[model samples]
Target chain A: MRKAIAASAAVIMLSIGAIAGAAEVKMVGTVQKIEMQGGAATVTLKDTKSGNEVKVTVKDDLTLDKFKDKRIVDGDEVRVKYDDGDGVVTIFRKTAGC
Target chain B: MTKILFTGLVAGAVMASAAFAKDHPGREYMEKNGYKGPETCEVCHPGKAKEFLSTVHWTHASKVDNVENTDPAREYGMKNRIYTMCNGNDIVNNLKEIPKTPDAKGTKFSGCNTCHPGNHLSDVGSAGPEAEAAIDCLVCHSREYDHSKRKPFKDDQGRVVLGQDRSVKAALAIAKPTVKNCMTCHEAAGGGVLVKRGFAFTKENDVHAAKGMVCVDCHKAKNHKIPTGFDPNNWAHDGVRVACADCHTETPHKDAEYNRHTARIACQTCHVTRTGGSFAKDFTTWEKLSNGYYEPTTLRKDANETVPVYAWYDKTVANRPDFIGPKGSRSDKASRIYPFKVFQGKGFFDRKTGELLAMDFAPPMSNGDTLAGVASAAKILGIKQYDPVPGWQTVLFGSNHLVTKKNALTCNNCHAPNGVLRFKDLGYSDDEVKRLTSPELYLQKMAEKQREEW
Candidate 1:
């Protein structure tokens, strides 16, 4: 009975994690350029591993603040988690030691 | 039921984000309504705004009449320092008023006022409550501030001033000044990365910047007055200073012999060996290019491994208002050997009164005429025509960045023959120079001392 309960909990946690993972595409890279238009901003990033450039649009007010104020600029490495479908970043932070 | 649950989950996430807004002293009403202007920030934090208004970041000088400086011919921030860049201060002079003359007809910008929060060629945002609307609080506080979008406009008094994007969302993003916050202005100085200060924080070189230290970490601001050690070639300091020993111990090194050197050696001498990679400008002159636009002629440049000039510096050299470099000698107890990045250039001087030349970025230079600008500046100064006195001299700036333990000097660096230091040049006698250079003799002395200890 205890073994069965443990297996059931494991399955539920895996199911929840899969749902979250499927909705987001995560990456880490250095910023190459950031272009803002109206309320929308597009950031081009040079992938740290693949060495390929990926463009991701950011619409959140908090992330937009970082771009406008130059917190995230060219040559600064950042970690990003974006929507898999629309490629809009949901979480963006600088890859810093602190 | 399933659709209802999904909607509820979305609402919960939204509420969680709203709860994350910084709980601070900002007026609650302004968060809902849009930020009215730069003056509104002062309304919420009246004390902080008052303290910030007194800073060099706001006034450019420690003491001066905000509207007019002691010398009208010179620009507002030219103060008493010698202008070394390209032999003239015009490259950065942000004058308050554009001269009403044909020579200045094409001059749109008073000078390079890009970094200042006030944005105006002069009159930084607000000198008092009257100028508060012109203040750009985000430029120094928010990492997300976009200074390139900051525009110049005419105020109620018809004076041209700089304005910023004063949205409420930008205002709410304020935090302590980060290294990134300072870089929006500092990195852009001298028109390129690491060109002006030759100090950039990177994981490979700087342990402080890499460990996420902001500029305010070392340049600690007390009541908004950041302590900048004086540079004879630049500006004066406030009161306090930024020193390595403030954090590091008097005897930092574990080894007794290495630790003993702390009495006469600055931390920067062994650490900051090179800066501004090979492309960094060592020589700059206002000599016009073939295109006719006034630009600096760069001479010698340095890279990551470039050797720096060495000098004996007094402990208080950085605090002195008149001399950027302190006069020191081997015999001086308060002195230490320091490293300097020696910059060289040429510019004009007044042969009659013997005054160092400083002038506005005259309209002629804006219209791509170099000679006209100099002539216009002379007319403004009410002086006779001038000639380019060979301004060629070693203008030394402290080499205090690009620190790395990887390239730190070994004992042979100073003691070995053909090492980095020149013993005779540093006031050492011939016998002393011989003794300092000869490693065999040094080894013998060490052996004798070791035998005695045993």
Candidate 2:
């Protein structure tokens, strides 16, 4: 019984570590397209540094007020933070304004 | 204890030296490189420095009397108020109050350092006496100055760093101001190449440049006062001398009719045909960054050869206060036919007030605020009700450069009834258009010629 309890605690700690490690990944790129559907938005970015395309889906809970007076437009330089696990954008920031 | 005190004293001395050294790196670099700074030039060229200081380049703003000479400030009013990006601080004014700190939004004004070497906008912390001393004498005199590594000094917050570290080595490269150097700022004026004056000035396109004649050959300057005959207020000034007739004779063309047209038509009307290239147009919109500096985004360009728009310019000013006749009509004594580049674009303005809102289209919006939309732009301009004025106005830019002598317009180009020259729009009477374009009129002239032959 004691061994089983210790094994269960170890598993819980490992699961927590894995959850912490799955943090969001930030990237700098140019916005290729922005598709808004209902309460969600999917943005396609062409990475300026790597020249690779990245697609990030933004849910209703995503924060985007950082752009201040500017709106998200195609071809704008943007810095995006996304969940590494689901590739969902959590923060959409316009980098060109800076 | 003794060793610690000695170390502390040494460190303090080093820190003090570093602070003092940062103030004048250009001078130190010149001393080390065996090249003399502006101080050395001033010793020998004091007269030239004094004369240059009086010129418009150093003053940044030209003094013009107001149409109504009632205000004292009118004496120092700018000739081209649209290009007044830099506040009056850049002008060598004794009475003007200099700002204690650089503008928060990193707004750069066209000042003395814009054309003068060794002077820098980022290093404006050393403005008064120190900046005057650091003038790079070799920028216009030496043939080796390289400003390739120069970059805008910005802080970690992305705001332009005031009194930040500059690359001393980058500023030391000396060179005589060539056509390339002059174009460095001029080409970028009004936001980049081919945007301002509509002259696509390239080595291959410019007729005089192709002939190996430098800008100074025609724009002769004495005491640093360059001749610009376009300004009506300054036209009578003794410094205004160079004109088309100065170089090209009155009868430049072999045809007598063409020679007769010179009195009413500007030289550019026949010389400049079209301008613009693939990399010529910059339609990029600048967005404010978090740090208060604006960066270009939504970069777009259109490469197309645009024909020059002909106008009636009285040779006094490129853009006069009153409206002239239509495109082809030359009626007024103060007006003659001239070619111009008509720049069309959309902008925002106050609908209620009918005033054009000067948005922070160019970076460093007057206030250190970010203009993200109509609301933000209105707030910056202090407008209550504003709307986007799409395709509102067409700006007229004088097309004087890019002369293609081979592609000169023929008589039919203008004389034909439906020719490029819109005679009707130019306020010409219907009778005049009929007489100018009528085939029967040509037949009558031919019949008269035949009778003379008989």
Candidate 3:
């Protein structure tokens, strides 16, 4: 229950952080874990370069459907651009496809 | 031609926006400056340029990592490792510096590095912005990149020079590399265009290419270092290796019988059914002609259909220069039945040292001195001067590409009597061969292994 609260707080920060930090950082990372709730989803990504787990919230409808359909599954390497301050991914897509 | 280049330019300009090309944030800056040099790209991507500067693609040599050379002293590429193609006498030794363009005579440019992406070969272990500035970024990033324009020649000043196409259009076209980008250099491998390595991974040859999969789909390059699996003879690099298991898991087949074969057989062994080349340059022998002109006698053995020689191989087979192949036995679990392209050429070899002497006979004769280059290489190898005997150098090239599921080998293809596979030569006993040829026995073994696992 405590873990769920932390995750919920993270999603709120993503919404508020979008306006705080506009400078998006692009990086390639492997998907470690995914947690979905209502219209919001949090993806745990292990950075390819630093090997650090970064929790980023995804609000995009297309990307959310990709997760639901298993098209973007765990262990998939994704090239993402996210707001470092809020932890919301602007661009999230698999690195393996054409 | 002008219209097409203009159309490509206009389209590329639209895509060059910072949002469109996230990787090339400075794409517009490069275009505005007419893509002056590798330095301009550093204005936005200093980190990317810095990461790529010291790579083998740029420096042509790096500290011994995956080289697997027998000589402990073979610590770097090109500088060490006596190459089978040119015997450490190609552009790696000849090219001293980069000039602006290929001279009128086109004498300064040599082979090997000709296929290399870099406009000039940087110093080994070199880093920093100065080295990064010398790198030609468009060659690997732009689909419109034309390698023919980047020619090397000797200027009247007697300095080696290179001609480059650094247009704003080319800069704007820059994006993440595609098959077209990699193939611009990789396609011209071996000898002139459409030779050995070039034949593989084409739209018609490989299934991946047919489905529009690029080299990176399998190669999986990070930063600048691409994973090369236990590089072939003369290929010196120390890095992670790409394996079939990376994509196809250890157990790829539905049936246990086929999956069991993966333990002893390579993915390419059955998939790469034949090697191709319309007029492939085969066995070449050099003759010191009576008129002091050296003549080369080349026999094109296989026109287009060439079967690869299956041999027991592991990653470390290329360290031994005398034996340029995968070194492993059938008994070794690390080894598998891998396909190979055997190269036979007449060259000088030392009988006492068993050192495959550098074949001075040149392709377009880079140095023009037949024995002079050989003698210098011999000195470096610490080979005592003696009567140089005429010897045949058998070099083996790995056949891992040009794959097709359609033409994959069936059981009868190798198991039938007088079959393509020579089981005895491959260290198989007569009884073992008989058992291997029997499909029932192979299935039984697979079932037994699966049962044991359960």
Candidate 4:
């Protein structure tokens, strides 16, 4: 009984760590390019704050609804959210008025 | 003893009369000149004066809660306070609570009596019924108020001294307001005729004016709350109270396809092809003078013939952002394709920060300047050093005038190969244009196959 309780506590701690490790990363940047291929899009973004360029991959099925009837394009100032663990972009939105 | 008493009474009477004249100088002057003041007009049009006070023309700037406050100049702490050229001396003095610091001399214009007839002289406070009599009712009501005679003289403090000859003429000629009366100040706004916006009110090239529809017809003011059609987020909030659908309903076009296009295309996209012609120049370059005024160096090479740039706009947003680089896709529901008069100019941007500077630097004291009037703006904005960016900034304003339906673009104008509409830039796939343009070929092939089967 003592051994089972210790094992359960260990599993819970591991789950918490896994969840924390996969925290979402948000960045504001201008899109430099979007290369679409095989139901996925690879977007190159130039960070507005840091001025550094980063390439992010977005899967086709990963609900890009924030772009809502619009596709990601070059020269678009967008705010993007991505899962840091997998390094995959999940959401994109225009950051002009907002 | 009788002579002394009589002399004392005469002196006292003179002193009392002098005090009365000093207190009500504006009223005394109007009474002597045989001019009935605003008080007389107010007795008949009582609600007008109260209603006019609520309008942007009377107030100049929108209230703090209004969308105008969301401008980058205000949001980024560049413009500390909303200072308008329309406020009188009394209003300016009352606005001391709003924090503002101007570095340059003679930058701020004192009083708005030059344009606003209802406002009294800067010295004579518009207070009681006697003071309220100073409102010039004929400025808006009369077509005979000659603008050339309305010469404004300012004291050393820049306050407008009223009692000009035009004031009396304005009072006498109380007729209904006409298009000419409205154009006196509006046409000359931003230094010269049609200098502010390329499509601003000019006698020629204005589709509405050519159609015999005056400014008041579309921009009907009720209690002076003139609707400006500025609210982007809500069509209901568009101050102009009128919409294109009001005149041209949902089924304006006879063709089903053309009528269907209305769901995705703005009316001005087809109606207003180009602007800046006739009385106005196509392009104007403002050069700042040593006297701190901007003079336009106009380029009229393509006057009235320049093609308007196209963009997508979401009407629901107040203060729409410029040029989102065409619709991302044809399915973009938030935005409709719209036409714009593109104004290309060199504007200052911070080289270090890469942020566009939001300082007013231009002609027309009311409309804040951005780039050309930077020297004067630097003082007002409290910026010490100035470094201009290398490239030019292209600003786009919606062109809804100069409407010539005959000059409207057809489908081939945009869909053809090497057309003005950049399909790739509009976020269409590579083959989208080829597929859209050559539907006839596919139909021909299908017909040939059907004939072969027969």
- For residues A35-60, write the lDDT of model 2, one tens digit per residue: 77666667788876687999988773
Query: How far off is model 4, as Cα RMSD?
Result: 29.3
What is candidate 1's lDDT per residue for A8-48, written digit by digit as tens? 99999998886667677788787889999889898998776
RMSD of each: 13.9, 19.9, 21.5, 29.3
TM-score of chain A of each: 0.73, 0.66, 0.76, 0.64
Q: Model 4: per-residue lDDT, tens digit, B367-408?
A: 334344444445555767767453344445456666665667
lDDT (tens digit, per residue) of candidate 4 on A1-98:
99999999999999899888898888878878777666677778887668888888877442232122132345656667888777687556443210
Instruction: Judge candidate 1 against the unseen true structure and give its global Cα lDDT, from 0 to 1.
Output: 0.59
Backbone collision count in every prediction? 18, 14, 11, 15
lDDT for each residue of candidate 2 in B1-454, tens digit (9 for 90 to 100): 5436544544554454344334333456455654545455555357565455545555444443322222335333222232112111222211111122243323333222333333443232234555556554544543333433222344565443222112334334333244544654454344433344435344456766565455555666677677765523232232355766665656677567788888877787787766442112212244443333443332222212577667776654422222111222366765667766555434444455544444433323323332333454355446565654422434455566787766777666677787677778777889999877766544555576579989
lDDT of each: 0.59, 0.49, 0.60, 0.48
Task: Output the lDDT of residue B179, model 2.
Answer: 59
What is the DockQ (computed on Cα atoms) for candidate 1?
0.07
Model 2 chain B weakest 10-residue run by lDDT: B91-100
User: Taking the tens digit of each residue's C-alpha lDDT, what string does model 3 give over B294-330?
Assistant: 3234332222257778888866655553556777789
Candidate 3, position B210, lDDT: 71
- Where is the poorest 10-residue window by lDDT in model 3 chain B? B98-107
